[model samples]
Target: MVLNKKGIIFSLLAIGLAGLFVLLFATGYQQRLDDQNDVIRARITSLDQGVDSFYDYAAEAQTIAGTAALDALYQEINQSGTFLTSDNFESNFTRCLNSSDGCENDLNLSVLLTNYSAIIATSLHADVQFSVNDVCLTQETFWDLVVRTNISISLTDTYAAWDTSRDITTTISTVGTYDPAYVAISASYGGAEDRRVFPTSIAPNSSRWNISTFMDFYKGRQYQASQNGSCLSDRYEGSWTSSFQGCNLESVVDADEHPRLKDPANQSITHMDWQVLTRDMHACHDPVTNPDDFRVSISDADDSLVLWNKDTIRYGLYPDHLDFSSPTYNAPGCP
Candidate 1:
């Protein structure tokens, strides 16, 4: 059969043109896909930034709120000269944090957070929500306390959404707050003019007793590391009701118990134990000439040692065992 060259040539040309059309279609489709992906990635990046910005605002609000509440509480304590119980402190802190009318010291955390959240929404043009769940105070150092605020945050943008919670904390130095013990001491013992003595008149269990406050003030002077396992040292009490004589070294705690008396961080010791340790001042020593007056006697063996003694005891006499002059002193006299 005679070959049709022109027809064959036309067939080849048509086949080539068809393949070329398919190649062009594939390249165009891939380029469009890349552009779409790029736009999505950009939107995701912007949304991520919005979430971060929201977090920053929430953290800052927590710090300011915590500090303000603490400062206000401090002022209240200063003006009243009354030691607020732990429960009272917590209640007041929450009241101050959420109060719309603001505290007497002029701080309103509720208003601060609301304004901050509004700013975030306006700037990012995104939906945002913030809720403060809790504010807690924990011991950081002997002289420092930490305030932690937990906040829940949710943010939604056109391309992304985020929901999370975090704890934002701030440290408050005791130096700034002034030693709470000193405040109690000055108020109870006739200001700085009188020797800060632990009045024997106030029963150890009395709510007005400042032993726990003094323990915190004493810092490193804890029971576990101090005495030889007993809460009171051996001493004669001639002035007692003719019945109580020698040191009644009460219940002896295990060597490992109450490793840290001032442990605000872990709180290893119970409140009851804390009370017992501070209240046993009368168990070991003779009440001074005046039953209302309790004198702290230092050991002659070691000037830093806290010994239970009668009114005739010698050196290292400061208010009880917790004194400013001695840092290494330990009082392990009561169970």
Candidate 2:
């Protein structure tokens, strides 16, 4: 009876040991699986953050590049009196964006993206590539100049077995950029072929009006006729010939050397300067005393008046024509 009881106790102890081993093995296996899942989740979160950062960086770059390009275009028009053309805009934009192209102010868009990709590659232990397919520019509103582009970004990580591509659009604003009216007036005179700049420089030019005399006759509040010492009527002096007669640079007496226009100047457009655009440059030579002989009155119904074509006007985009002189103003004896 004693030997049989000892055998039963030994058998029960062996079965208990086997159950404990199985329980320990199951717990260890579950813990290992949980640790692996946590690592994967952490990696996914890191990748998501990286992607978001990349998008933000790209957007900022595009905006800066677009702003630079737009600014350059306006400068070109301002300096050279050139008109904008849609067909040549992409090339011009690229030139402005690249520093190597001799652009006055270059953002170097390609180099910026390359450096950004390198930083991303180092952080994620992956390969990053950015490709620019096309650049499209649009003026959505008078204040908004939108830059849309086909930018493709590819990210690949071998360890995570992850690869992805994304497309993004970038925008820029010109709310307070170059004056729109200034550009319109400059372009209206002539494009690059026959560029003409207003507020003529303080130098001698037979064809264009000199700044000193222009201000004296048009903007001077104390303007007078040289012959009579009488105040000349404030009007657009569009009728003048090479003889320099009748209320012109040679005939008018300017009391103020640096004259201020009656109306406040905005974007450099003077009241008389803008009004001159409404009439033809009629050549008049009055040797005798005639106050109104060489004057082109804005109120004159006989004088041809031009109105801006609102139907074809656009903001920041190319307008083929604006209400300005066609065969631009020129003094007699000019080639």
Candidate 3:
């Protein structure tokens, strides 16, 4: 009986040790599962933050790209100051064509586009595209170019040119001072009888005596080149000098009129016009006619002179000089 009791005590001790091991394993497994769940939750939170960042980045990237486009537009405007003026435009265009190696002052398409694109790429891996209305500033279009960014937002404009023309024919108030020989030569060539003779009012020839001044009528020694009315003008700021009608061109442009986004809330937007005009100063002259057009006409009922569309038209000759009867014709005859 003493041996049996000792054996039972040993068996019970073994059972208790096995139960402690089972309890420890159950608690450890549960703790491991809890730790794994916490790790998963932290990962999920991190993923959500990443997604928010991506959205913000895309939106901010769009804003940056748009701003860059505006900067480019402003650059175009600043660089092309008064380039549309007749004097600057014609001369520069001619120079470009006459160049053998091509024009150095020609428009640089790559520079304009690449500069804009590089700025965006360096800041963010975004796409950008640029195109100009006219590659050479041909004065063909109102919009210099269109810039598209993020494949959605775009900016551009439309332009139209209007020219004013009117009749500018008038009788001369005075024949202006002329050399006696020149007067004699003019009278002999029927210049005095020319109703189309421009008065001493036009530019460069403002002090001229008659239309025969430009006529190659031999003044006995020198050959005269037909003097067309001309005005000296500088590009980028002003128009042609006018002693008669104003030689100005007007331009009007219209865009979608999109407001600039001043803040993120789409509020406090500012608007600006796309139109720019050649607002030149009025020319100095006597008895200022109309500033509306560069054309004019003058008449004395007997004869009429029309300076229309850059041409002089005469319907009749000076009074009594009809059929061209010189008061006193005395010349060595045609050479």
User: Relative to the true structure, how large is the alpha-carbon lDDT of every model?
Assistant: 0.45, 0.45, 0.28
User: Cα lDDT of model 1 overall?
Assistant: 0.45
**Model 3, runs deviating above 4 Å:** 76-335
Ranking by TM-score: 2, 1, 3
What digit string (tens of lDDT, one per residue) describes model 3 on residues 38-59? 9767654543443343334433
Model 3: residue 307 alpha-carbon error in angstroms: 26
Question: Which residue ranges in model 1 land beyond 4 Å of their true spot?
Answer: 1-21, 53-61, 75-86, 98-116, 178-335
Q: What is the per-residue lDDT of model 2 for residues 193-230, given as tens digits with 9 covering 90 to 100?
A: 22111222222222233233443434332222222211
Q: Is candidate 1 or candidate 2 better by TM-score?
A: 2
Point out the worst 10-residue segment of candidate 1 by lDDT: 231-240
Candidate 2, run of 10 with poorest lDDT: 230-239
Ranking by lDDT: 1, 2, 3
lDDT of 3: 0.28
Every candidate's CA RMSD: 14.1, 16.2, 24.5
Q: In model 2, how large is the Cα lDDT of residue 186?
A: 37
Superior by TM-score: candidate 1 or candidate 3:
1
